[model samples]
Target: MKVLEKQARTVDEAVQLALEELGVSRDEVEVEVIDEGNKGILSFLSKPTKVKVTVKPKPEEVAVGFLNGLLHFIDKNAKVKCLPEDEILKLEIESEDAGILIGKRGSTLDALQYLTSLVVNKNCEEFVRIVLDAENYREKREDTLEHLALKIADKVKETKKSIMLEPMYPNERRIIHTTLQKDRKIVTKSVGKEPYRRVIISLK
Candidate 1:
């Protein structure tokens, strides 16, 4: 669970403002109005009340939770110890046989990661992005993706021809789009169908 705090002149305003900033709705948050500004008499000016708001993490957990669960299962089923680390609700699991959780092509691992993040973020009233990783796989993949984005951007610039990149997951595609979007001489666009879709980088 995450705790997000904010202040506003009124309870409604505090909630509304927090909701906007947190990307959450009224139902997602439990609000506490800590203070109302002071109102002074005659010679003094009235000050708007200050409010303190704390937002708690939602109950919903994501796919990563399932991976963590699976890790537990493996530990119990195979007698391997699964250690868990919760960094601000971002769960990282370390086990003796972490490879089993990773699975082939990291598919099982990805599924678990995806679910855990989904559940945690959905239930989290605050904008807490839950990241679950086992054996540093996600970190390595992220590094690779970052390098690939840079490589592709360089290629697009060198060739001076619109380059079509391999289809990628939404996150990967986002990385590509973000990496090249700032280039003054080029523009990026996503084309093709889902699963087989790809991004196009063209000279603008």
Candidate 2:
């Protein structure tokens, strides 16, 4: 949260100054009148009114708050931890049944991550990427995909036939393409449109 203190002849004026500096609306901030100046004798020794204004918390703070409410609504006994690095927010879910959160092939986790990104970036000036994981599921899934890609490439080399894998999201397809890029006997390409797009491994 960003905080600022300002002083003017009136509390409203001080608040206005704070709002302009923070570049936020009145409803988006908390304002406290530190001192309502008194009109001294002849107004010659009067002090200016002072106020302290605080802007709303950062995106990470907002995201954590939202996740807490969401977890409670789902009745899931889990804890969310956020780590911000550069332009990406890494969120991890800790729970005894973490696999349930990951869902089949990490579809559920991807959906949750998308929603969280929307919530965090709504009305934000600069968008930040959100990466969600549960019990290191993302890393494990990447490793699995890389292994599958190599295995498929070997099969393609031996049979001299192209094999089209099941439909996958773009990120998953990228993993397959990247994993086989350096193989001399095989190549990879993505086929079809979104939601049904898949990777095809074939002999070079």
Candidate 3:
């Protein structure tokens, strides 16, 4: 993508010149005026206009570039080999005794993945959906969540009431809600505040 600007007698003329220079149609470029031309008493004596023109990339290219950067960063800094799948990216990191990356209950790894996603989205000219995981961590996490949901749902059935599960991030909560969506005897709902919010399972 490239941006170009120039001053001309009128906004329309300025945009036209930009399109000509960019070798693109008028619809392909975005034009914004930094300074509108001042029209004098005589039409021929109008002040020059200043406008900015930008060219954008196609959505697919943007998504590829974003994933490329993510792969590079993981390989260079984390010393991990990452491969981009059709809809997700996978990483392999050697197991360490300290397990610093996993943090407390894999919080650090989760935070790293989130930050990587932010960087990819920031650099791309178009929106791209990226999912990062280490050694199928997301799949394992999903299974764990399903088990927990079933356990809580059983408790709810036995007690004939609701059971409040500990707070989780939006993604984790979604997993819980989705995993139990088909169960006719149990229902899931979110409660409390963000960062401290939790999921409640009740008998349906």
TM-score of each: 0.53, 0.77, 0.59
On residues 12-97, what C-alpha lDDT tens digit does candidate 1 reach at each position? 77667777887877776677656665556842676554454445543334434455466565664322223334544555666677
Provide the RMSD of all predictions against the true structure, rounded to 1 decimal.
Answer: 11.6, 5.6, 6.4
Per-model lDDT: 0.64, 0.87, 0.73
- Residue 94 shift from truth in candidate 2, angstroms: 0.7
Q: Write the per-residue lDDT of candidate 3 for residues 1-204, one digit (tens) a residue.
A: 889997888899998889889899876677889999788999778789999999765433444455446545444334454565675555544333225555665676677666666765675555555555555567787899989998888888888989898888788999999989999998899999998999999987
User: In each prediction, how many residue pairs overlap at the backbone (N, C-alpha, C within less than 3 A)?
Assistant: 19, 0, 0
Off-target runs (Cα >4 Å) in candidate 1 are 1-68, 72-88, 97-100, 103-106, 118-128
Q: Model 2, residue 136: displacement in angstroms?
A: 0.4
TM-score of candidate 3 on Cα atoms, chains taken together: 0.59
Candidate 2 per-residue lDDT over residues 1-204, each given as its tens digit:
699999999999999999998899997888888999976787789889999999977788888888878877664688899988887889888888877778899998898888888999986778878898888998998999999999888888888899999999888999999888988888788889989998989988
Off by over 4 Å in 2: 1-54
Looking at model 3, residue 140 earns an lDDT score of 83
